[model samples]
Target: MAEQPLLDVEQVSKSYGPRKALDGVSLQVGRGEFVALLGPNGAGKSTLFQLLSGLFVADGGSIRIGGLDLRTHMTAALARLGVVFQQPTLDLDLGVAANLRYHARLHGLGGRHARERIDAELARLGLAERAQEPARALSGGNRRKVELARALVHQPEVLLMDEATVGLDFASRRQLLDDVHALVASRGVGVLWASHLVDEAEGADRVVVLHLGHVLFTGTPAELVAHCGAADLAAAFLQLTAGGGRHAA
Candidate 1:
């Protein structure tokens, strides 16, 4: 039997009244895989993330996380997924450790177990030495690292990073991307990282090009280049999504 993917989104569709934000979009992320959801601004990437995060339900189709159907088992499906949204959600006034503690508690994690997990994640992200500092005191990259650590504290089977590198400098972005890829390798965690930047998708195990609510392409970076007959991933992405489509609001 074929192994089930950790994250499976099949023919998922969504709309905001008259606008079809996502139409028949499908993708899968296996354990230990890093799948990049590459697209442009207003390409409905945010809509897809919203659906995956359970903030909004898809108008049609299904999303499964860790083999649990999201529609039938919302709590269980969500429990297996970790998410870092585009917007910063950390409380700047709180200490770094305090922030992670709150999230761990929200997931019903407590006591020594929670502490151990928190410590472990902090160490893994190289934030252990800065645990006592206020969140605002750290650099943008470190703050993002803290969020990544908090997301992993519960040991979710699938991680969703929505435009996670939006505000960081080039080096920070590169390092953060490297860190997530390392997580896939070390922990066998499935990742679906959404971004508009083509450069970020070059090193992914696979790239799913989504535009205008549709998945235009899915393959390795090299395959994408060959398929489009383009010189590089960036040029291929531009050509694949050249025709303008309705933008999600």
Candidate 2:
């Protein structure tokens, strides 16, 4: 039998009173795959992220992470996911190691094991020396790296990044993307990266174009451009999201 997908979002739907934020969206990410969630500002990407992270319950449909149903087994499902939200969650007052340690403890990791994981992640991200520095003292790129390290300290099989490169400089963004790609390549971690930047999705294994709470396209970057009859990903994204004045959910 074929193995189950690492992350499966099946016909997931959500509504806010009169507005339908997501309507029957379905997608899957296999182990070691990097799937880019491409959409405009109001294309319900954030809503979907919220649902996946269990921040807000889906009004309809189901989500399964590592073959565990989110609704029926929230803890088990969540335990398999490592999430980095758009907003920075690190406590600026705390040292980088402290912040990571706190997250590890939340996931039942501590003492020697936690320290080993923390040390490894910090070194991998090139933040080893900064481990003792306050989170606020680091540059934007380093702080973002800290968040990524903390997310992986639990050694999750799936990673969810919601606009993770936002507010970063060009170099920082590129480095972050390279880091994520390395994670997928080396660790076999399935990743669902949500972003509005077409450049970020250029090399993704697959791209799911979401618009106005609906999926407009799902294929490779080349396929997306071909489907839209555009020359490149940016042009294709503009063409796909055009003619819609939809507000984000």
Candidate 3:
């Protein structure tokens, strides 16, 4: 039998009053694989992220992380997830090390071990020298890097990034992508990256195009273009989502 994927969502559904946010959404991310969740604003990406992060309960379907059911084994399933939200979650008043230290404590890492991990992540992100500086003092790109570092302090097996490059410039966005790609290659960390940017999804192992709360397509970027008979991913995406109607919240 084939090994189970590290992250799996099957027939997941969610709704807010009369509006359905997600309808039978399903996808999988294998170990070290990068799957991009491509969609427009209000395309249910945020809703799915909320469910995956345990902030919102799914009305139906199943989510498995590392073979643990998210609903039945919430703690175990959550332990395997690392998330970087689109909005920055850091306290600007706190020093970089202090922020990371708090995250470490939350994950039950403290004292020497926590320090070691913090040092290692900061060094990996080239932010070791700025450890003592307040978070507000850092550049946007570096702050995002800190957030990414914070998310991985617990050494989760899978990473969920919800439009993590939203406010970043071209260089910063590319750097963040490269950094996450390296993590996948070197640490075998599975990633489910949600974004509306076609360029961001270009290098993904697979792309799941979501429109109007449904998955319109799932395949490699090149395949999506070819399947749509378009010139490139951007054109393909435009053609696929055209007249699909405004995304449902």
- Point to the candidate with the largest lDDT: 2
Question: What would you estimate as the lDDT of candidate 3?
Answer: 0.92
RMSD of each: 2.9, 2.9, 2.7
Predicted candidate 3 versus true structure: per-residue lDDT over 1-249, tens digit per residue: 167999999999999999999999988899989999999898899999999988899999999999999999998898889999988999999999999999999888999999999999999999999999999999999999999999999999989999999899999999999999999999999999999998999899999988888988888888899888899999988888885743221
Candidate 3: worst-modelled 10 consecutive residues by lDDT? 240-249
lDDT of 2 by residue, 2-39 (tens): 67999999999999999999998988899999999999
Note the clash tally of each candidate. 0, 1, 0
Off by over 4 Å in 3: 245-249
Q: Which stretches of candidate 1 lie over 4 Å from their true place?
A: 244-249
What global local distance difference test value does model 1 have? 0.92
TM-score of 1: 0.96
| Candidate 2 backbone overlaps, count | 1
